[model samples]
Target: MSGDDAKRASDAASARDKLLWIIIYSLCSSTMLVINKLAVGANGLPTVVAGAQLAVSAAVVVVMEFAGAGVLGPFEKKRIVPFVLYTTMFAMGLFSNMKALMLTNVGAVISARCCLPLIVCSIEWFFMNRAFPNARSVMSLMGVVVSAGIYIANDTGVDIQGGAGMFWLLVWWLLLAVQMTYGKHLTENIAMTQWERVFYTNAMAIPPTIVLYYATGENELEMEDGEGAMFYLILSCVVGVAISYSGWKCRSVITATTFTLVGVLNKMATITFTIIVWPKDFSVVKTLALIASVGFGLLYTEAPLRKPKVAGAGTSPLGIKH
Candidate 1:
């Protein structure tokens, strides 16, 4: 084959690898949510549980680095601002999500997160000076919103009266969107490998997470019996933190649109797992609505937008250059 053909083949392989990483990350994240629900239901404190997991994952990364894997690296000074902000956003999103899980059903929380793509897209357009392609994108955003509403309306298990829970869940979704966008910016300049990046991010997160864990009066060593609490904790550390981070590294390679789309699918996986494990009371209408919301969010985020053919030319409708 010609050089051009070889380059195209290489590019296609890279894309496939990235997509595989994303799928693994989404599945791992979904599993983390499920394990978290089980652990919390078994009386595990969310802060302590998550903190411990982070600590263990960090240690594992450290060990891998020492083993000549070159998977972790020294933190860069210039990236501090964005790194800290993104890490803080990560902590807040997780804290809010865990709190919401305690107060509401998993399905409801997942449904509420359906709005995240719209939030991310708007943030990119308005705050970051990006633009969408056409009316189709806007309609797709509306579809997600409407679908989320239908799902929520039909959800009998959701405690709308759980005032603080609802508030925190919405806040969690917003923070997640912001975190992803900011994370993208950080990835643009940071030179670390995927594993190293995850290590550094989690490392920075440790001190704050520990403080929160202690402030919440949660004991790290305390594990309830018969709850599979320990197993869940380990799962969160290995699969959730380590593997999911690997997946997200691939995501940071793609456009923010790809990241959001993967996230929406991850939410769907979480919802499906919740239904299977808990067998909650849910309506077909609600189920369909939830599916639709997730579907639309994926569609909107992945929609092919027009791009400028010339570099440094006028901005394309899709906010990207071809």
Candidate 2:
């Protein structure tokens, strides 16, 4: 083969590897959500569960640091502040998502997540003035909105009509926008590697996470709970680390756009898997809603182009944008 042919083959292999990592990242995240829902929904605790995951993640980072494979870089005052803010919003998102899922079916929670592609774009437009939803995006968004409305009305998923589930979920969704934008700032301005970020964010989060957990009184209560909830909570920690690791690897290989698109598609698989494994009232409307939300959401991903470089942005893996 010609030199050009060899180059093309190498590129194709690289693309395939990235696709495989993306699939792994999606599966880890989606599976963990159902397990989280189960743990918190069963009269367990969200704050404590989040703490456990952070602790496990932090522990892994500490081990990495000891193993000389970690990026325990110098303490920069600039990144520290942003790291704190990012981790705080991240913690809030995690807690609120759990709180919402505890009260509502996982399907409703997943359906609402369809707004992410739109939300992320909206944030970029407002804050960075980078991009906005195009004609195709709007058309695709219409399908997601309509499907969500149908699900909300048809009432396939439970407890959405009443209670604070929708409210918390909305908070979770909005925080996503802030976290993503802040993350871009971190990668571009502060110069933190993915591993450095994983370590710092998890470390910074631990103190605040403890505060959030105890503040909610869940820590005190969960400590008194039965062993089954603890099992799921502990299991969620293992799942969380796996998700983060896969995400870190995937982000190194792909752009934020590709990661988000994979996530949109991942929700479809997650919804299907959640419905199959988790007990829920059967409804065709719900199934269709889940499918349409994800299927149409796929249109939001633009063709493979160079990741848009904003005037003041740096590249980083998709960290905790889920």
Candidate 3:
């Protein structure tokens, strides 16, 4: 076979593998959400529950490190500042999200997050100096966001007004925008491997989560939920390890547009699963939003405007990429 043919075949295999990674990450991440809902519902204190999950993830990473498979880092001085910012964003984003969920109605919570693509895309176009997404991809992503907003508007009453919920949701959105964009930039521009990042960020999460856990107070703590809750918590930890590791790896290979759009789709999966498990009272708007979300997810996946790379180029050259 010609070199060109061999290169094409190799690229096909790699793309297929990355696709598999995205699929696994999305499924695992969606499952983590369900598991979190189950465990946190039984346990109360979302912050403390999050702390436990992080500790679980950390322990698993530690074992991998000792096995010589996922040793964390040399964590060079040059990268320290960015890594600090990365982990801070990581922890705050998650903490705020949990807090928002607790404070708001489902609608408000979802609305707060509906604009994530717009936030991430703006960052990519302006700060990162990347090309804008194609019109179709942008439109489809907008559809996803709009449908979600509509669902929220038509389906539920405002459970909390002029409260901490909106504030936390706004905070969560901004932090997550920074978290993901900086994370991709760190993996793309810096010297850290994916495993080092997975370890460091998970390690970094522990301190903040513990702080949040303590802040939640002794009164909120429940020593015993149930035997079943323990199972869900343990299972959540195992799925979480996959979620963190694959997420880091996937971001390393894709554009911000692709990563966050994939996230929108992942949310759809979680919400879909939520509806199925509980059989919630639904409105016409709610059903439409769910259906449209899945449709847009399919469209975005097929036409995801990825980062520019030279065709059949295995090694990269110096300088900026569009």
lDDT of each: 0.66, 0.68, 0.71
Residue pairs clashing, model 2: 188-314
The full ranking of all candidates by lDDT, starting with the best, is 3, 2, 1
Candidate 3, superposed: residue stretches over 4 Å from native = 1-7, 98-104, 157-160, 163-168, 218-220, 283-285, 301-322
Which has the better lDDT: candidate 1, or candidate 3?
Answer: 3
Instruction: Work out the TM-score per prediction.
Output: 0.78, 0.73, 0.84
The candidate with the higher TM-score, 1 or 3, is: 3
**Each candidate: RMSD to true structure?**
4.8, 6.1, 4.8
- Report the Cα lDDT for residue 137, model 3: 63
**Model 1 weakest lDDT span, ten residues long:** 313-322
Best by lDDT: 3
Per-residue alpha-carbon lDDT of model 3 for 1-322, expressed as tens digits?
9987777777667676667777877888888887888877776656656767677777776787789885666657776777778888877777787788888777776665667877887788788877665566677778887787776677784465465766887888888888778877898788876667776777777887777667767446666586487777777778877888899888876667678777877887677666756776745667768778767655553223347755635411111121
Query: What does the lDDT come to for candidate 1?
Result: 0.66
Q: List the candidate 2 regions with Cα displacement exceeding 4 Å.
A: 1-14, 38-43, 92-112, 125-137, 156-172, 222-231, 249-265, 277-280, 303-322
Stretches > 4 Å off in candidate 1: 1-11, 94-112, 127-130, 133-136, 156-174, 219-222, 276-278, 301-307, 310-322
